[model samples]
Target: MRSIQALPEFHVFFNDHVVNNFNTLFISMPSSKEYYATGVSGSVHNRLFPKASFDFIHTSYSLQWLSKLLKELVDKQSLAWNKGKVSYPNSAKEVVEAYKMHFGKDIEWFFNARALEIVSLEILWFFLIPSVADSHCKCVIIAVFDLLGSALMELAVQGLVDEDKVDNCNLSIPDEIASLIESNNGDFI
Candidate 1:
């Protein structure tokens, strides 16, 4: 960052999906003499910049979001119909497969786009030195989400939220994401 005198000045792009509040970001962003900030709004699955536009790119707590909800989960006739559950935990095999396949496609698109946008020999730092949480901690988080789903189910039972609404909803966590990043072997980073 600005503290590093050895590195050249770099442009900072604050990005999010198109609906992000850019005004708040601009107002809240730290003013720096060493770098200028630009706001870029778009999905990483699609190119948000010209080829070789950046020498560095970073993402954090982002890949957990899916590109979009999988249609198969809402389609009652589909094998992947995910009724009565919001998260994939304890879901049917078909549901897990659907989420896995969707994650694969999403991350592929992500890599493809980043591959085009970055300069050769530049750093993507996509993982950004992720700190692994222990399994028990991960389970606690998943358990929290499960409790939320259970509450929604209770509401559906009381005719508060329609049952179909619960069926169509899902939380994205992409369990296969770590493997996907490793499989790329630095080619797309």
Candidate 2:
């Protein structure tokens, strides 16, 4: 069994808390193996693991980064800062739709891969960015904003600021991704 979830501030904080409480075996190590990185909906299933090899899986705050919806819309402004124009958010509906499609598919693959795992109890949790709730504790919100702003500035320099686009789609919740996971698993807690 495997668990797939978003990577949110709360999730990170909670993970650390649980680790501290349980004194469990947790390794804060970077990947030593060469791993493939792609968009959320791209092909994590294949890159992260072979077919049905994992016993458990976990993803947090990572999937939201794949939301090309807002990224596509902000892409126009991204280009204004630069000169390259591969695809603008305002270019066509397909771009936005493509973003959504990729995001949805990413969610699907995450769950499907987890279902193929052999664990008996898979626990999945997630965290989302730019959360709508006011309970985020000001520190987390400010930190996330600072990080996002800095990354956007870098993207602006590289002519890739589609990340700053208008957020018309309210798809910033882990629940949406969690739903996909539950659809494939037994229960969601």
Candidate 3:
């Protein structure tokens, strides 16, 4: 909040969902900063402010979540169905593609919505996790979802957990910065 207040004559509007602790946010504001502040409760995927209302938008570790899961992944008959898995494994080519497509659509929607609310050439900052570098110059990360799914499956096999619960679990991976920039024609950056 202080960082935003540093910009001369800038008013900071912090957005969060209804479940957020807005009181704490308001209470924490230092009396020294003269800038005005407001809390908006809503999803960034949709417009929260009027047209050309903001000069800067900042998001951290939030854009990775897709608006919804890929339809094909949930459809049992679809080729992208991810049976027995909560997320795409490195070997699951089709699952990876499905996630990528879903991410692309989500990003496009986010930018389109933001385009209506933000002024042209206004700054947008998104802090995201980068892919892990591997020995073969490839990007890889320890599959936390795979571990979680495996644990759930083990419990189901032992009759300690419901198979249906395990079947319903799914996770989304964050897009690489390059893909995000490319998806929107590098306009948002």
Candidate 4:
């Protein structure tokens, strides 16, 4: 809503469970680009939180923007060939490859960092873009929307495209969280 500088230091912080008496700090940024500029730093995390640290990490629509995983894939595919056009099957393969080569690491690292913050018995719920719940139901409302979005962009441009699809694939982050908690059994809260 407002710039991180304009808000009180703690306004952006939230702790679902209050432990000890440490306060939740909020570091709100005005725009997504700036929000990311502020959010993505190991140094910024340390500085703004100079004497404080987190016990849990939570996020909503923000992670998608930060990674720009899908958008990057689309851009790469669109530029892969001469005449500014890519073949249908090639486009699909390029997209998949981009995801595998690029976004895969970013997603893995992001969650790994988050997993370290959660303690035993803590739950992290994510409302993701391609949400797990609707992943398989092709006829679901959002599935259609995803199809349309793909169609409007690469699918239509590439032609001979039978179905434009966005797989609502969901990942099991709880296991990662549990592993982190178990690994640090006696080290933290």
Could you say which candidate leads in TM-score? 1
In candidate 2, clashing pairs total: 12
Q: Candidate 1 lDDT, tens digit per residue, 1-189?
A: 577568777787877988999999788766665577888898867788999887777877677667888888899998888788887756777887887788788888888888888786467675521222332345655777788889999999999999888887788656665677788875654
* Clash number for each model: 0, 12, 0, 6
- Which lDDT value does model 3 have at 93? 64
lDDT of 4 by residue, 1-189 (tens): 875667433324432222323322333333443332222323111122422245445566443332432454334245322112221122334443444444334555555555555553265565444432222444343445455455545654666543232222211111123344365572332
Worst 10 residues of 1 by lDDT: 128-137
Q: Lowest-lDDT window of 10 residues in candidate 2? A: 10-19
Report how far off residue 9 is in candidate 3 (Å).
7.2
Query: What's the distance in Å from true for residue 90, model 4?
Result: 12
Candidate 2 is scored at a TM of 0.37
Among the numbered candidates, top lDDT falls to 1
Clash count in backbone of candidate 4: 6
Model 1 earns a TM-score of 0.76
What's the distance in Å from true for residue 99, model 4? 1.5
Give all TM-scores, in the order shown: 0.76, 0.37, 0.69, 0.37
Report lDDT (CA) for all predictions: 0.76, 0.43, 0.71, 0.37
How many angstroms is residue 96 displaced in model 3 relative to the true structure, after the best TM-score fit?
A: 1.4
Model 2 segments more than 4 A misplaced? 1-47, 67-71, 74-101, 119-121, 124-143, 146-175, 179-189
Deviation in angstroms for 187 in model 2?
9.3
- Candidate 1 vs candidate 2: the TM-score winner is 1
RMSD of each: 4.6, 13.0, 5.4, 12.8
